[model samples]
Target chain A: MYWNEKHECIPREELEELQLQRLKETVERCYFNVPHYRKVMQELQLEPEDIQSLDDLKKLPFTTKQDLRDNYPYGMFAVPLSEVVRIHSSSGTTGKPTVVGYTRGDITTWSELMARSLVCGGAGRDDVIHNAYGYGLFTGGLGVHYGAERLGASVIPISGGNTKRQIMIMKDYGSTILTCTPSYALYIAEVINELGMKPEDLKLKVGIFGAEPWSENMRKEIEEKLGISAIDIYGLSEIIGPGVAVECQDKSGLHIWEDHFLPEIIDPETGETLPPGEEGELVITSLTKEALPVLRYRTRDIARLITEPCPCGRTAYKVTRIGGRTDDMLIIRGVNVFPSQIEHVLLETGYAEPHYQLIVDRKGTMDTLTVMVEVSENVFSDEVRKLEQLEYTIKNELETTLGISVGVKLVEPKTIARSEGKAKRVIDNRKA
Target chain B: MLKQLSVFLENKTGRLTAVTEILAEYNINIRALSLADTSDFGILRLIVNEPKKAYEILKKDGFTVRITDVIGVEMPDRPGGLNGVLQVMKSEGINIEYLYAFLGTNGRGAVVIFRVENMEKAMEILQEKGIQVLSPAEL
Candidate 1:
């Protein structure tokens, strides 16, 4: 199952050396070409030469989602626009998108790494990859597409949605691997049963699911429902799409492709790197990307890195699957929706109290986003028709702003729980 | 008009019994009780001897309690007696959100507690039509 053991299974010392070399080169690239990175580096009086070893990585300034947002479309690209062969972004409803540009060589590197990731997930040239990640601007579809193609696996380039069609194609083609969000995979399994088709009718062996945070119970649910090994894959458009790390057949933790993306866990509040195995926010540095190589980019995904040797034999570290985020960002149906975004909409509508809670739950196979808000005592005491009309107006305004339909629960004042310091704004029952 | 106590309880075993236990401890006689439920929670509406006292006790016990205004309509023990009040309500466009009944005190007749869109108007109309409308004192 090892596609490129030369890089995937590099010895620890050699891997660190390779990471340091690539880190140094990427630092120089970012510090010279991109003004944002250059300004950030010069602010600390830190030069590329200072990062002679990987330990000096802490000296470099940490780039954040705000940094990517501040430098909107092409400001973060290290290479010139002509050098960028493709661009991908995963934008929220309100603000600027987190953009990633890829050079031709960068695409080749991504495909190679994605191929390695697929091999780790027990997929190979003989397996047919049902690439269900979205295509075009969103990175998942094309990322897995090119990666499966590079692995010499026959790829059914079927993008997300169209559940019945996907099942039909999968059965007709005898596709051996399914690729999409974990929730969508469950929805597909549900559809198979609705069509009176059993899991045995389809020849699915492995699933490469990512683009959202999923739980172990969800993994088991998918495995049992689809009669396949559900492997977790992790990636974001800000770094490279769908193949930065993946769970091997051992099903322990995600084996991060450390040769390309150097992973770190840092205290989100103090900006201090925690010891390995301690739960903290994950930060990644793009080591080999040519077009938009990032330095210590704060991923905001909370996880622990396991450096202990794994049965999979990949010396690269694995990150424990993330269960929560450091920020109040809620990913609803693959779209990132912040509580502040909903709050902003509520405030702009001029109809609700500042207090609100985002209740996220799994309604069957789909994620249900229910925004709970408390109204003024006067508003609640009003006639039922007025309250219903106000709820309608608030739902409409929120849908307009957040670009997603949400169940609006209007309660009386002082109903939503308040806090002393940080307000607990999101209650995600999906993990429970 | 009779004051009905509505208590919010989580949908779990022994929760309803716990509420009943609280009522029993306070020696509150439950005249009529109805339970409305959803998946996560349930609303228990009770017309007791002293709704104000029952509401205070439930509120002290950390239950979300609301004292609502409802009129008790005395129905003839016969089957059409219940339909008579409903027909009047339907003609007057008085929407009944919910209704519950209990045997009349002293074995006079059955009494139906009605939560209507306009409680005052329904009471006036029922009394004008020679229908018996029980007051809080009577209950």
Candidate 2:
């Protein structure tokens, strides 16, 4: 079941030695080649030799998303442009995009991590991986494509969209493994229902869903609807794409490939690193990336790290599913709200589907939140009073939980725009 | 037994039309209808020629639809006529959830569709009180 036992399940002492060696090499590479790292190290009066052990990692300066953006195209790259083999950019939905370059060795390392990622999900050479993650600059599609090929699996690089054609190919090609965002997978299940086909009819037995924050409730919904084991794969374009970590068959938490990317959870407000199993912002240091050697890149993604040995037996540290991104949180009338929180509420109430959009608007100086949730077909009621009761119940539950009043707008099924990659579930119309 | 079609609708511009259009496609004639809207959403109650068929088609089209038996009671067109049936129901300990009326026999008489807490109990109380409860055929 293990893909790379030498690295994936490396002995603790040996893994630490390898990490320290790699960290030292990376620090030396960055300090000597990349001016950004050199300036930061100089500002701290620190040298490459100063980072003696993994514990001393705290002494080094932290790199951030803002720093990456400041670098723009290739300012943060440790290697020369001629040596870099591939380049990928962030989604840039928020602001200016951050670009990353990969040397040939970096690509091989990424592919190997992805192979280990897929193997963690129980996908093998015999499995037909229908990679629905979008291709091109996003890094999800090509990142996973390389891994599927590396794992000796047949990859259907269908990319994203064409839900009908996806199902047709999935059935005809006997695709055993499905890879896409969880919401898109749910949409596929909805389309399958619309086509009057049960999940039992499909050959798909497992799913690789991530690239966005999703809830446990959503995971269960996807699993039951698709009749497959839906596993969450965690990764970011800044650190690496979808193979930075993955949940093993245990379905407990995502096991980070500590051999390559070292994970540290820190208090978002303070720079102090939190203890294991404490939730905070994630900071990653790339041990193997050659072209883009990011040192303690603050991922902005919120998650807790678990050092406990997983039942699946991989010794790599596990990250409890990402809670939400620091940048993605919405402040409504002084109350912080996350779309995932609304999703969790709806699913818990059993009144709405996984699809929903949080619309924030403003009148004068006061900000207002309007939650548009699609009514689940299972709970749709013709009785106006019952529907009203359900609506008020949901609104009250949200108000009590969120500590702010919100307008609940019940919408029809399939009305929310389906995402091919990451589900865009928030629309903020208030003035910035 | 009188079949009434209840359709759930969002209080949007064309949602009512959307439901009507589905019924129209099935050639189901809506004899009388009442819309109760509460800002966020609305419920369209319909007395159609083929209530069961309308409910089935609307349900198939992904609309929240239900077919329920509502007793249609004939009342005098004059004021206080509606109160006569309510008084009897209250006296008989029968609870009325909701009721709506429409002109019957060219505005000569009024028909009140009673959706009660217990349809059989309300119907029995109405029948025992010598009130005329119209059947599906009469509508």
For this target, which candidate reaches the highest DockQ against the unseen true structure? 2
Model 1 regions lying over 4 Å from their true place = A377-386, A400-403, A421-423, B1-139
Instruction: List the pairs of residues colliding in candidate 1.
Output: none
Q: For candidate 1, give the DockQ.
A: 0.06
Candidate 2 lDDT at A432 equals 43
Give all TM-scores, in the order shown: 0.75, 0.61
lDDT tens digits by residue: candidate 1, A3-122: 998888899999988999899999999989999988988899988899988889999999988888888888999888999999888755465667889999999999998999999999
Displacement of residue A306 (Cα, Å) in model 1 is: 1.7
Clash number for each model:
0, 0
DockQ of each two-chain model: 0.06, 0.23
User: What DockQ does candidate 2 score?
Assistant: 0.23
Which digits, one per residue and each the tens of the lDDT, describe model 2 over residues B1-139?
A: 5888877777779998898788788899987888887887777889999877887788788776777778899989898999898899888988777778888866558998878888888778788899999988887
Q: Identify the CAPRI category of the predicted complex in candidate 2.
A: incorrect
Per-model CA lDDT versus the true structure: 0.86, 0.84
Backbone clash total, candidate 2: 0
